[model samples]
Target: MAEIVLDKVTKRYADGALAVSDVNIEIADGEFVILVGPSGCGKSTTLNMIAGLEDITGGELRIGGVRMNEKAPKDRDIAMVFQSYALYPHMTVRENMAFPLRLAKVDNATVTRKVEEAAAILDLKAHLDRKPANLSGGQRQRVAMGRAIVRSPKAFLMDEPLSNLDAKLRGQMRTSVSRLQKQLGTTTVYVTHDQTEAMTLGDRVVVLRGGLVQQIGAPQFLYDHPANLFVAGFIGAPAMNFLPATLENGSLSTPLGTVALTDRVRRAAEAADAPREVIMGVRPEHFEDASLVDAAALDRGASFDAQVEVLESMGAEKFAYFSVEGGEAHASDLADLAADAGSAGVPDTGSQVVTRLSAASAVAEGQPAKFWFDTDKVQLFDPASGANLTYSAD
Candidate 1:
């Protein structure tokens, strides 16, 4: 396996419309790196550039320390697994996996041995004689993977390889893919728009938006300390709830009421030279039912009474949605987020907030419930630039 690096790489269409800006990423040998974003966010374009499927307009593309801008895709020594399982219906599983080896003019015995080994690894030995039409969606995907594995290329590029499967199968396949990558130790660059996939897989995640690189870090790092409003809104499930608040004298005047900032939060704000008008971001998991909080814990946070609009009890935990008095906070960077959250199927009035509460808490729908959120856990963002004013490297 070899490391792959994109140094200030850019891609502009023939029409001069920039599809990807000056972006840099380094994928170490045997590292699984993920490229993730909303649809049409230049993730695919970036992947294609690395795969030699698209031309690089600026900067350098290197694999194994060699510049590869002008190299044809076949010479890149990388295998790409696409979102669609592009399998040949006429070819059996074994034949499909052996096709690459045959094309390389390897001896028959070596081809057979390689195909058998790949089939064993993918657990497709039993279905070697079966055609693509006879296999399940997951199995077909594995066949595609087996085809790539037999090549034993220097690196692998997977473009949303599991998007076609059902949720349950996707979960199963995710485990399979991770384990397979670990076993092979091939450098991998996977592109996906799903945050769940981005969080679960990859040693490092590169978040992109509007053809620009947002933040690159471990999934939890991005979740805990997003660099900007877009990254904050895009990384987590249920998305981080955002509200407009005014900061003054180490305190915040929010829709939830006046909140006294903790020392850590205050320092972050001061270090950023935080503006009076800032956006407050709190993850759903950060909120708790006030009734369930201990006395010491309650003392450290602020409480507000909210009428639960919808309560979903998930057994171990509960999600409580409330409608705050003020409307949604809008940011140019979060324009897509607001649009997505406000889709027709999901009502996002900009007034709604989601809180995760302990399942034991006594909270019901359409009834007022006291909720508490940790003051130290709050993050402040500049509405104009979408920068996280209250960000701390720690």
Candidate 2:
């Protein structure tokens, strides 16, 4: 219902340890923004500062166009749902949901109406009389959400609200939360360490690292056009692949093969005014079966060939892992790759090159395989600075 803004927002502890720095973001009315990063990345700290639970050591926070630095949490007109599902165990669902309204001395009739409406919205009508002790973990989390929803606050701030649920339940709740946000049209700011949650739930995701924001955009935007190495590695299911390469005459020389640069990337590099010491990046899904690729469609130069090592079938598609002829030295820093695979557990086969092929494609492990990518699909970054070679034309 209201826009939120953070202007050069920063947070620091009494010990002088910085928690967040210079994070400036503008959340439009009714937009669901997610703050995401790894553990100890200051996401929760930033959320807490916005909720008025933590002091801002520098910068400013504004909600609905008013400076909120001196405002009490009660006056901020924001409702927060935390990870722990902070419900009063002694009270029934109805009582728990009605507590906030009661504190504001709302009349009993209005409280009953509001609680009934919230319970119905959350599908908790049948469990209103049940105590928290008797409810399942998912139900308890719904109760936490019901409490926040009943108030109809200016915005909803959620801090990993689904962390306590099982995987299946978490997936179900992800859809439920997203649907609820849209149905209510509430402005929301959600914080999580889970990349999938950030990718799926947010209108715009703010990727942060070490107290600084890496990038802010739609989920696919960050995945397709990362601003730096950290954003490149953090925003995808199977993160973008990075290979050391040297740039000469506008082409990147990789062990696998050379990838020709597009005019956009070339222009960006030229604008940066630096010699081309760069890293070449490609998404796992960007590679195609080399034989099937149309060379005529390419801009004079774009292609790579490698040998496959392992194959993984995910029902509708296959991921082929292999090694480029001389790519053994690049194997040491695959932590980013392993992390992106999540629970599948990336195998330790030596010197592997990986690409996701379509379900209809005929490629097998250990086969001599070739892959092709559009030149524009490739991303280039400064090896030393980790900054994207291509800044936006805007």
lDDT of each: 0.92, 0.83
Clashing pairs in 1: 328-350
Task: List runs of model 1 lying over 4 Å from the truth.
Answer: 340-350
TM-score of each: 0.97, 0.91
Most accurate candidate by lDDT: 1
What is the number of residue pairs that collide in model 2?
Answer: 2
Candidate 2 structure quality by residue, lDDT tens digits, 93-185: 999999989988999999999999999999999999999999999999999999999989999999999999999999999999999999999
Candidate with best TM-score = 1
Clash count for each candidate, listed in order shown: 1, 2
Candidate 1 yields a Cα-based lDDT of 0.92
